[model samples]
Target: MLYVFLSICCSVIVSILLKLARRYSIDISQAITWNYSMAILLTWLFFKPQFQNLQAAPIGIYTAVGLLLPLVFWIMASSVRVAGIVRTDVAQRLSLFIPLLASFLVFGEALTPLKIAGIIVGFAAILCSIPWQKKTANRKVISNAWMYLVVVFFGFGAIDILFKKVAAFREIPYTTSLFFIYSLAFIIALTGLLIRVFNRKARIVWPHIMFGLILGVANFGNILFYLRAHKALASNPSAVFSAMNIGVITVGTLVGVFVFNERLSLVNKIGIGLAIVAIILITLSQH
Candidate 1:
């Protein structure tokens, strides 16, 4: 239970940090680049993933996740920037639908009634969650936001599937795989940063580094405690997954509305309500 709480808190804090970064004009790309330095250090210290273990791990999967990670972070940053925390969080939570859809199509997994209902409701949640308005300019803002949200939806889902594939290799330690993923992602980001510096498009800043370090710690804690929750509830993975997603959406909505004063119309509220229901249904269907 503590693990669950910590995991949810850490996840929400990452979003909160990103929200604040925008307000303070933090360069998210640079922050994200430095974020991996902290994350890798933490992973190495705690997980102690050995160098010898890497030879057996799948390099292709690591590369894929590595590339996808930085790309998705940029998309998510865009999501939080343009869409607000509430919509971004809900869009991410509802991304569970992507893997389920892939499972049915690619893996030939059978869909039960609960799953069908969950899928329908999940799409509803997406449609309703967008910060849509009646005015043309506002609608255009939301319309562009939907594009970012959709990329977030599928981008994260693909990343999720890639991680699962790495996990399926029983011989490969999860920590070792994560270290490689972050390492490769760091390389990619560093390269991009150097290019930007050469073109005079970006420059280093102390505040962004500070924010990145904080975000990295929060990001590491998010995964660490979530894994701990799985260990605590070994008999029920579904519970861990369901609780984490629902908790983020539920609490994220509160913070966005109350603390940040991000507006959510009536339909958006209803959509969030259905998202909770959809998560439960999806979890039940798994069992």
Candidate 2:
């Protein structure tokens, strides 16, 4: 439980730092690339090379997760740009319904009435939170941010399912799985950066790089702690971690409103309320 709490805390802080970076003229792509590099290094430093005996199945699963690195960063950055941090986060978190349903279908995890109700409410919240305006007098006027939200939803959902599957495999060490997954992501990202460099469009923004380093360490903290927590509490670790959405939403909302000066419409407010209730119900159902 402590590990889970620490992971949630670190994730929240990372979000705040990422938002702050926008104010410093940081290049989002460079920042994300640097973040992944730092994450790879930090994960290695902590986990070391004790994962030499991990089975093939877990390695394959983590490799599939690594394939999502590029899409994940792109969609997350686009969502933040188009929908603002609060709404983007709401969309991202509420998308957990995808994995929940996937677990039921793939792993034969039974979904109780309470779980079904919570999932429905959560989906409704996400729908309400989406902004549909004819015209907006803002610089980041993205016509297809909703599409980016969908991408984030499915991308993260698949990643969660993969991680859960890897965790279920008894032969794989959790730390080893994470290290390989991240290392694969870093390799892919580095390749992309090199390609950009060859095109002479790879601008190195130092502030963004530093911010990415900070975010990388923070994100590593999140994954490390959560993996440890899942290992310690094998039964229904998803439910326990899912409950932390309340904390993420709370912190994201506060930061979005005060720091970013973002505003929510009435529908968005109602959506946030529904999400909160749904998260509470889901957590209670696990107990």
TM-score of each: 0.95, 0.88
Best by TM-score: 1
Candidate 2 weakest ten by summed lDDT = 133-142
The 0-to-1 C-alpha lDDT of every candidate, in the order given, reads: 0.89, 0.76
Model 1: lDDT to the true structure: 0.89
Instruction: Write the residue-wise lDDT of candidate 2 on 1-287 in tens digits.
Output: 78778877887777666566667777676777788888878878988746555545455677788878755876787677667778877876776778788878987988898988998898889887776653367555667767777787778888878877877876766666777777788777778877887899886657767888887989889878876887788887656566568767777788888888887888888988898887876776676
Cα lDDT over the full model 2: 0.76
Q: What's the CA error at residue 143 for candidate 1, in Å?
A: 4.5
lDDT for 201 in candidate 2 is: 80
lDDT digits (tens) for residues 104-134 of candidate 1? 9999999899999999999999999886663
Most accurate candidate by lDDT: 1
The true-versus-predicted C-alpha distance at residue 53 of model 1, in Å, is 4.7
Model 1 residue pairs with clashes: none
